[model samples]
Target chain A: MVNTRNMVADNYTPESVAEAVRKYDGVRRKQAIGSLVRSLHIDNIDVVASYGEDAAVIQNGRTALLLAADGIWNKLMEVDPYWAGYCAILVNVHDIAAMGGRPVAMVDVLSASDDAIMTEVSRGMHDAAVAFDVPVVGGHLHPDAPYNVIDVSILGVAELENIIYSSKAQPNDAIIAAIDLKGRIHPSAPMNWDSVTMKTSDVLRSQISVMKDLGERHLLTAGKDISNPGVIGTLGMLIESSGVGAVVDLTAIPRPDLDALGITFEQWVRMYPGMGFIMTANRSDVETVCKKFRKTGMAAQVIGTVTSTKKFTLVKGEQETVLFNFCEEGITNI
Target chain B: MVNTRNMVADNYTPESVAEAVRKYDGVRRKQAIGSLVRSLHIDNIDVVASYGEDAAVIQNGRTALLLAADGIWNKLMEVDPYWAGYCAILVNVHDIAAMGGRPVAMVDVLSASDDAIMTEVSRGMHDAAVAFDVPVVGGHLHPDAPYNVIDVSILGVAELENIIYSSKAQPNDAIIAAIDLKGRIHPSAPMNWDSVTMKTSDVLRSQISVMKDLGERHLLTAGKDISNPGVIGTLGMLIESSGVGAVVDLTAIPRPDLDALGITFEQWVRMYPGMGFIMTANRSDVETVCKKFRKTGMAAQVIGTVTSTKKFTLVKGEQETVLFNFCEEGITNI
Candidate 1:
C-alpha cells in the first residue's frame, strides 16, 4: 500500500475526517429512519428480519425472499435524470447482492413532470436493467405529475441457510472493505465513484455474485453494500445494527490513487463507490474473503476489527480519533 | 334487483356515460402507459407475463412470484395523507389478489416535506398492513423532501397452475362485475366508494380470497380488479389486453341506491370502488362464479359478453352506443 499518511494534506487529520463524516448530508439523512421504523413496524410470522438489513428477509417455506425499496433523491434527478435513473437500479441491485441473494426481478413506480424527462429516465433504467441482466417486469407510471421521481423495488431469493445479515457482527471479527477502484468520479455527481458503467454485463454480474459465493461458503459474518453514506459512514451503520463497535486503521482502508485523481483522502472516504462492500468475517476466514474479492479485480483489505467498546474509532499510525460512539449517537438508529 | 332506469337524471344516457368515462382524469392518465411500456419492456426467460397484468408473473421452479408497484397521486397526498398511505397498501394488496396470489409482504418509498406528514403516512401504512395481515417489511424514508409521495411494491406467491392472467379472455365469454356495495362514498374523495374501511379483517380477507378460490377452481377465463379506470374502463383494459372486444349491458350492471347516495348513474359507474372486480368466465361457469362472490357479501351479476368485433359497446335496453373502437382508439393501448 502507498504511504497515504505522508500524502495526506496538512489539514487532513483523523479528528477532521471524523468531524467531516459526522456532519455529512448523506450520513445525516439516515437519522430519521429510527423514528419512521417505529411507526411502520408490525409483527408478522413470515418476516425473518427487517429495517436494519440491506433488504428485509421473509421466510417462504425453505427459501428466503429478500424485499427492498429505494427512491432517487430529487437533486439527483435535477442534475442528471439519466444517471438518476441508472443509479436507482444500481442501488437496488446492491441491496439484494449485499444479502447474498439472486435478484430475480424488479418493479418501478415512476412519475415525471414532462415527457422529455420521462423518456430519458426510462432509457437509463432500460440500459441499467439490461446491463445487470435483470428485467423491469411491471410498474405504474404517472406521466403528468408535477414532480419527477423514480422509485424501484426489487425481489430476490436465496436459500434460508445461506443468507448474510447486517446484524450478526461479533466481537473480534475482522472488518474488511472491498471496492472496485478502476474508474473515475462521476461527472454529474462528485460524491459518486462510477465503476460499474464501464464494465461488461458479464463482469458486473460476476462481481455481484462474489457476495453470494462468500455467503454460501460461510466466510462473512455480517456485510452491507457501501451506499450513500460512503465507507466509514456505512461501516458505522453496520456495526450499529449489529450492536457492536469497531476500530478502523485509516491507512489500511483500500483506496485508488487519490493524488492522481486530484481528491483528498477525506473526499475519497465519503464517495459512494459504484461497486463496493464492507464486511466482517472471522479472523480465520478473512483471508479467504479478501482473496475472493481480489479475484474479481476489486481492492480488498482488512481495515479494522470489531470491538465491544461500542465506539467507532479511527487510527492512522500514531493519530487516533473516535468517529461515533453508538452509546450516545447512531448513524441509523434503527 | 333495483329498477334504476326511472331513477336516472335526464342527462344520463349511453352517450353521456360513455363520454364521461372517456374523458375522466383516471382514464386519461392511463393513456401514457402504452408508450412507457414500450420503453421499459425487456425480454427475459423467466417472466411469465407483464405489462397488461395487474401483477407481473415470474416463473420460479413450481411456483409463480407476483410483483407490482403503485404510487399515490399527489392530489390525494395533499388532501389526506392518512388515506393516501392506507390506499397505497390497499392498491398493492389488490394487485396481488387480482393475480390469484397470496401477498406475502410489502416495501415502500416515502418522501414527505415535514415530520407531521411522514408520521401520518407511516401510521396509515402501519394500520393497513395490520388490517390486511401483510407485513410492511422494509422501505426508504425521505423525511425532508420538498414534496410528499408514497410508492409501495408487493411480493406475492402462487402455485403455477393456479395463477390467473389478464390476457386470457376469449370470445363468447360471459362478463361479470363483482363489487361490495355495503358502504358509502368516501368523504375524502367523492369519486371513491368506501366499501372496505368499515369491514372487519376477516370479512375483507374473505372477500379478497374469492378470486384465489376461483383461480384454484379454474372457474374464470380472465380477471382484473376494478381500479382507477372504474368498471367499464377496467373491462376495456382487460379485453384490449386479450385482443378482444366486449358488449356491456349498462342496466344489468350492479349498483347501490343511486338516489339514496345522491349520485347519478353516470357518476356512480365511474366511481372507484373500495372492493370490486370485473372478470370474464366461460358461459358454463358464470353462475358458479357469481354465486361464489355473492356468498362473500358482494353484488355480482352477468353484465355482458365478450365479442370479437374489436369494438367496446354499451347497451341499455333498446338503446346502444359504441364506447371505444379498438380499431381506432384504446383505453390503455397496451
Candidate 2:
C-alpha cells in the first residue's frame, strides 16, 4: 500500500521514480519527436502553434482551426485491434478537446495484415465515433500490409478568444489534476484505464464540453489532455512549453481505489486514463475551475503550484524530489 | 514493344487486360474500404463529400475545409524509408489538389523500428514539405515499432462556390489525362514514376495549381489526382463516382516512352506517376484545359469520353475492352 502521508509515498527514492518515468516507453517514445519537429518547419502565417501542443491551431478569420494526428502502438494493435481502433478515435478527439475546440470530423489510415482483424478495428472505431458524435468522414486503407497500423487525424473549430493554449501557464497559477475515477483498469491492457466505453453518449459529450466552457469563461491559464505519458509526464510537457515549473504535493493527486484495482500508485500514474486532463488555473479562478470539473463527476484538486524556476519537483511530507529539470532535459525535448 | 494502331494494343486480349488491372495490388487493396465506410456513419450536415472523393469536404461558412489521409506501402518503407517519407507528403498534398483546394498544412504519424532510419525518413519528408510549401504542423510518432510505417493527413481550404467534386462529370464531358513526361521511372521503386523530386518547385506548384484554376473557371466538371491505382484505374473511380462511364482510347493516353523505359504498355498504365491528373471537362473546354496543363509542362490529352452507361471501357483501333462494369462492381464501392 502507498503511504498516504509520506512525500516519497513509499520506500521509492526520487531517482527511482524519475528513472521509472524517464525510461517509460510512453516518455521515451517521445524522444524521436524533437528531431522530426526541427526538420518540419512551420512557414505558414496562419499556423499559430505546432509541435508542442496537443493540436495545431490555424487562424481562420475569427475562428481557429485545429488539426492533429495520432497512431496506435503496434503492440496495442496486436494485443487488441478493437481497442486500438477505439483509442485511435478517442485520442484524436481529445487532442481537439484539450484545445477547447469542437471536434467535427476525422480521417483514418488503417493498414492491416488480414480482413477479420481489420473489421474488429473498424467496429471499435465506429462505436467510438458515434459515442463522441464526431464523424469519420473518409480515409485510406492498406489491406494486405505485413503489419497492422491505425492512424487517425481530426479537425476541429473554436472561437479565437476561447482557444486554450498549453504554453500560457503563469508563474502563480495552480496546477490541477482532473480525472474521472469511476472506471476499472482495462482487462486486456492494464496500462489503459477504461471509462468511456461504458458511459452514455450524452455523458461523454458533456464531459468533453466542460473544457470549452472553461475556456470560454477563462478559467484555466493552460491545459492539456492527459495522454500516454500520464499526468506527471504530461505536466512536464505543458511546463516545458510554458517555460515554467511546478512543485506537486503527491498526496493531493487524484486516484481511484488502488488496492481494489490491484495496481501500485506508480503503475496508476503511468496508465492512460480514459478521461483525464491537467490544467493550470489562475489563483483566483482555481476554486471555480475545480467546481466546474466536479460538476461533471471528475475528481479535481489543486495538486501543485506553478513556479518561475524550470525544475518540476514532487513533494511528500518533508522530502522533495525533482522530476524534470527543464533547463537540462525535457520529456519531448521540443 | 507495343505496336501502334493495333486493335489489341500489344497482342493482349481484352479479357486479360481487364483481369490484370482488376487484380492489380493497388486496386485490390482498396477492397476493404466499402465495409468500413458503411460502419462509419456521416451524420454531420456540413459534410459535403466523403468516401468517394480524394478529400472529404466539409462546409465551413463561405469556404470548404478539405481533409484527407494516406499511408505509404509497407514494402516501400522497408526498401527506402526516404522515398516512403517523401511520398507520404506528396500523396497527401495531391489529395487536396485533387479536390481543387490549396493545401495549407499537414500532420504525420510515423512508426519506426529505429532512430537512424527515422531520421532519414524525417529528412525526406522535410525536403518534400519544403518543396511543396506545405508545413508539417503536428503529429504523433511511434519510435520502437516492429515495422516502419508513415501516414500523413492534409488540411486544405477552398471557396465553396469553386470546389470541384469528383461526382460531377457530365454525360458528354471529355476525360483529360495530364501527366508530366519529363522525368524517368523512379530508381528506388519501379512502380513509381519520379517527376516531382527532380522538378523545380515553380513547375510543381504550377502543375498543382492548374486544378484550382480549372475549378475557378468552371472548366472541369470533375477531377481527381492520379494515385496508386494508376491512370486507367483512377479514371474508373472518377467515372464511378459520377455514376457514368468512359471509353478511353489507350493509344491517346499520355506516356513517357515505355519502350525506352523497358516496360510494357500494361506496366505503364499501372505505374503511379508522381505528377498526373484525370479530369472531366466539357468538349468545348477541353482545348483550353489541355492548353492550361501544357503551360505547366504537362502532357495533357483528351483520350476519352464520358457516357451514361455505368461501364468504363478502353479502346484501341477497332477493338474495345470493358475495363470496369461499374454497374456490377465499382472500384471503391463507396
Candidate 3:
C-alpha cells in the first residue's frame, strides 16, 4: 500500500482533526438518535436486531429481512433537490449493503412545496434507482406540502447465518477503510465525494457485493458504510455500536492525491464518499478482505485497530489525540 | 343488513355530495401521484407488482415481500404532533394490511422543529406500534429541521399466491366498505375518525387480520385501505387503478350516528377512519366477506358495484350524479 503519511500537509495536527470531526454537524446530529430510539422502541419476537445498526434485521422464516430508512438533510434539499433525492436512495441502498444483504426494492415518501421541486427530486430519485438496479416500488407524495423533503426506505434479504451486524466487532480486530477514490468532489455538494455517480452499474454492484461476499465467507466481524459522518465519524459509530473503541493512524486512510485536489486531510476525512465502508475483521483475514474490495476498484487498507479501551484516539506520527470516549459521551449515544 | 335509507338527511343530494368529494383536499392531493409515478418507475425482475398497488410485491424466493411508505400531512403535524406520529405508523401498517400481508416491522424518517414535538411524536408512534404489535425497527431523525414531518415505511411478508392487489378488481365485482362505526370524531383533528386508539391489541389485530384471511381464502378480488381520501375517494382510486369504474348508493355507506355526533352525512364520508378498508369481491362471496369484518367489530356493507363504464357515479334513491369520469379526470391521476 502507498504510504500517504508524508503527503499530509505540515499545517495539520491530530488535535485539530479530532476537534473538527467532534464538532462537525454530521457527527453532532447523530446524538438525537439515542433519544429517538428510546421513544420509538418496541419489542417483537420476529426482530432479530433493531436500533444502533445500519439496518434492522428481522427474521422472516429462513431468511433475514433487512429494513432501513433515510431522509436527506433539509439543507441538501434546499441547495440541490436533485442531489438530495439521489442521495436519499443512495444512502438507503448502502444501509443494506453495509449489512451484507441484497437490496430488493425501495419505497419513497416525498413532500414538496411546489411542482418544480418535486419534478427535480423525482428525476434524481429515478436516475439513482435505475443505476442501483433497485426499483422504487410504491410510495406516498404530498404535492402541496409547505416544505420539501425526500425519504427513502429499502428492503433487502440475506441468509440468516451470513448476515453481518455492526455490534459484533471484537477487540484487537483490524479496522479497515475501503473507499472508491477515483472521482472528484461533487460540485453541487462539496462535502460529497462523487465517486459512484460516474461509475457504471456493473462497477457499483460489484463494489456493493464485496461486503456480502465477506459476510458469506465470515471474513468480517463488523461493518458499516461511511456516511455523512465521513470516514472517521462512521468508524466512531461502528466502534461505539460494538461497545468498543479504536485507535487509528490517520495517514493510513486511502485517498486520491490530496495535494493535487487542494483539500486538506482534515476535510477529506469528513467528506461523505460516494462509495465507502469502514469494517472490522480478524487480523489474519484482513489482507483477503482488503483484496476483495481492491478488486472492485476501491482503495482498501488497514487504517486502525479495535481496542479494549472505550476511547477513540487518532494518532498522527508522534502526536495522539482522543476524539470520543464512549464511557463518557457516545457518538450516536446508543 | 340494516337499511337506513330513510335516515339520510333531507338536505343531501347526489349532486352536492359528488361535488364536495370531487373538490376535497384529500382527493385533490393525490392527483400529483400520476406524474410522480411516471418519473419514479423502474423495472426490476424481482418486483411482482408495484406502483398502483397498496404495497409493492417483491418476490424473494417463495416469499412475497410487501413494501410501502406514507408521510403524515403537515397539517396534522402542526395541529397535533402526537396524532401525526401515530398516523405515520398507522398508515404504513394499513398499507401492508390492505395488501393482505403480515406486517413484520417499520422504519421512520422524522424531522422535528424541537425536542418537545419530537417527544410527542415519538410517544404517538410508540403507542400505535404497541397497539398494532409491530416494532419500530430503525429510522433516521432530523432533530433540527425547520419543519416537522413524520414518514414511515413498512415491511411485510405474504405467500406469493395469496397476495391481494389493488389493480386486480374485476368489473361487476361487489365494492365493499368495511369500517368501524364505533369511533367518534377526533377532537384535535376534525377530519379524523378515532376508532382503533381505544381498542385492545387483540381487537386491533383481529381487525387487521381480516383482510389477510380473505386473501388466503381467495375471497377478495382487490383491496385497499380507506385513507385520507375517505370512502368514495378511496374507491375512486381503486377503480382508477383497476381501469374500471363504480356506482355507489349513498345510503349504503356504513357510518356512526351522524345526527347524534353533530356531523353531516357528507362530512362523515370524508372523515378519515382510524380502522377501515375498501375491497372488491365476487357478488356471491360478498356476504361472507362482510360477515368476517363484522365479527371483528367493523361495519361492512356492499356500498357499490364495479362497472366497465369508466365513470364513477353516486346515486341517491332516484337521482344519479357522476363524481369522476375515469375517461376524463381521475383521482390520484394513476
Candidate 4:
C-alpha cells in the first residue's frame, strides 16, 4: 500500500508502516468515490446493489446481470499501451468474476491521438480478450483525441443466490488471501505482477472461475479482486462496505521470495498481481476455500480474522499496529 | 437532406446535397469504425448481434440483454462540461431505447483533471440519469488524470422476440422520422438541439418508450436513434447496416423553424435533436407508428422509402440527389 519495508521491526516500525499506507496515492485517490456516489440517485428498483461492490448487480428474475467499467490510468497508458489495453479488459473481467459471475461480453471506449498507440492498445485488448475467452463485442472510438485512454465495460450473468457480495462478511469469518506467486513485476509498470500473460487460456479460465465455484458452493462470505489499491486497501474497502474490520497477520499473507524479487513487504502488499483475491470465509470452511484457490495454482492462506472492532490492524511477531480505523478515516469512505 | 428548395429540377442539384452530407464531420469521423470492428472477434455464443446495432444484443434464456458504450467528444467536454456529462448518460440511454429495450442501469469511467469540471460533469450525469430513471450504479474514476474524458456504458433488457435491430430494415418499408421540435439550439453547442432538458421526466419517459411500444406492436422493420450524424447520416448507417437503400424526401423531414432560429435548412438537418429517431416500418404500420410519436408531442412523418438498391437518395420537387451508395463508400462500414 506504500513504501517498501524490511522484515526487521527496527527497519520498519509499525507506526511508520501505518503512516505510509495512510498517505499512499492509491488510497488517497479513492476519497473522490464517496462524493461521486452521493451525487447519483438509485431510481431503478431492479438495481440490487451499487457503488460498493466490484460490479453492480441488477435483478432479472433469478438471473443477475453484472455491469462494471474500468479505465486505464494515464500513467499506465503512457508507460505501455499494450499493458494498458490488457489491463483494461483484465480489470473489467475481474469485476464480474469478483461478483462470482461469468463474463459475457465487453465494450470499450478508446481515444487516441495516433494510430500506432491505438493499434497497440487494440492488439493488447484483442490478445487478452482471446486469452480470457471473453469477446470485445462493440465500443465507441475517438480516433483523433489529444490523449490516449481506454475504458472497458463488461456484462456478466449469474444467479442472484450465488453472488459473492463484498458487504456480506461476518464478524467471525476468516480473511483469506489468494494470489499467483509465479510472475515477475511488469517491466513497464513496476506495480503490476504479470502472471496471466504467460499462462494458457485453459489455465487462466479455470483460475478465474474458481470464485464462481466458491460462490456456487457458498464457501466464502465475501470476496473482492485485488486492484490498484492493492490487497490491504482493497480489504479496507471490502470490510468497510461490510461494516466491519479485521486484524491481519502480515507474516501470514501469501508471498513469493520477496527478498529475491527485491520488493519490500509494504510494496508486495500493494502490488496488483495479475490474479489475486481477498476473501472472507467461515472458520470451518476456510480450508476448503483456500484449497479451491490452491487447485488453480494460486497460493491461498488465511491472513487474518474479520472483527467487529471497525479497525484494520496488522500483526508481525510480537508487534501489532492499526492500519486503518474504519470508524475514523476509511479508504473510499463508502 | 439538405437545403429546402422548390420541387423543380433547377432548384436544388443532387450533387450539392450529396456533397453537404458527405462532407459532414459526423459522417467522416465514422469512417474509422470499420477498421476498429475488424480487429475484434466474437467467440461468444450469446452475442446475437454486435457492431451494427445501437446496443449489442446478447441472448439469455427468453430474455435479451443489451450492452452499449458511448464516449463524449472532448470538444463537447471542453465546450460545456455539464452538457457533455448529461449527453454521456443521455446517449447511452438512447442506445438501449433505440434497440427497443428498457434500460436498467449504467456505469461510467470518468477522468477529470480538476474538481470543478468533475463536479459539473457528475451533476450533468446525475440529472440525466434521474430524468431517464436509470441509475448510475457503479463506475471507475481517475481523480488525478491529466485529461478529461467521460465514457458511459448501459445495460438494458427486453424480450428476445421484441428486440428491434438496426440491421433488419426491409426493402419496400416506409422509413419514418420522429423528432421533438419543441426545442432551441443549445447555447453552448450549435449542433445540439435542447429538447429533453425542458421536459418533465414523465414526458421524456413516454417519448423514449414509443420505440418499445412500436416493438411490442411489431410496427417497425428496423430502427436507429438519430445521433451526431443527424437524420440523414444516421439513416445512412441504418440502411447500410440493413444492406438496403433509401429514398428520403427532403421536404418531409421534421424540423423546427429554421429561419426563425437563424439556422439554415442545411444546419437544422444536421443538428442532433435531443429526442429523435429514424425507423423503417411496414407501409401499412407507418401511420400507427407516426401516430404514437405524434401522441408524445413529437413530429412524425413518412419521410423516405427503403429500397433493395444499396443507395441513399434525397428528393425535393423534381430534383433527386444520391447521399450515399453503400456498395461503394459508406458511413461506419460495420
Q: What is the TM-score of each predicted model, taking all chains together?
A: 0.97, 0.97, 0.97, 0.96
The best-first sequence of candidates by DockQ reads 3, 1, 2, 4
Predicted complex 4: DockQ: 0.79
| lDDT (0 to 1) per candidate | 0.91, 0.88, 0.91, 0.89
Question: What stretches of model 2 exceed 4 Å from their correct place?
Answer: A1-16, B1-16
C-alpha lDDT of candidate 2 relative to the true structure: 0.88
Over B175-258, each residue of candidate 4 has an lDDT whose tens digit, in order, gives: 999999999899999999999999999999999999988888788999999998899889999999999999999878897867
lDDT of 1 at A285: 95
Give candidate 4's whole-model lDDT. 0.89
Measured with C-alpha atoms, the lDDT of residue B217 in candidate 2 is 88
Docking class of 2: high
Query: What is candidate 3's local distance difference test score?
Result: 0.91
For B25-51, candidate 1 gives per-residue lDDT tens digits of: 888899998888898888999999989
lDDT tens digits, residue span B115-233, model 3:
99999999999999999999999989898899999999999999999998998898899999999999878889999999978889999999999989998999999999999999988
| Chain A TM-score, prediction 1 | 0.97
The regions of model 4 sitting more than 4 angstroms off are A1-13, B1-14
| Leading candidate by DockQ | 3
The better candidate by TM-score, 1 or 4, is: 1
**Chain B TM-scores of the candidates:** 0.97, 0.96, 0.97, 0.96
Question: What is the C-alpha DockQ of each candidate?
Answer: 0.86, 0.81, 0.90, 0.79
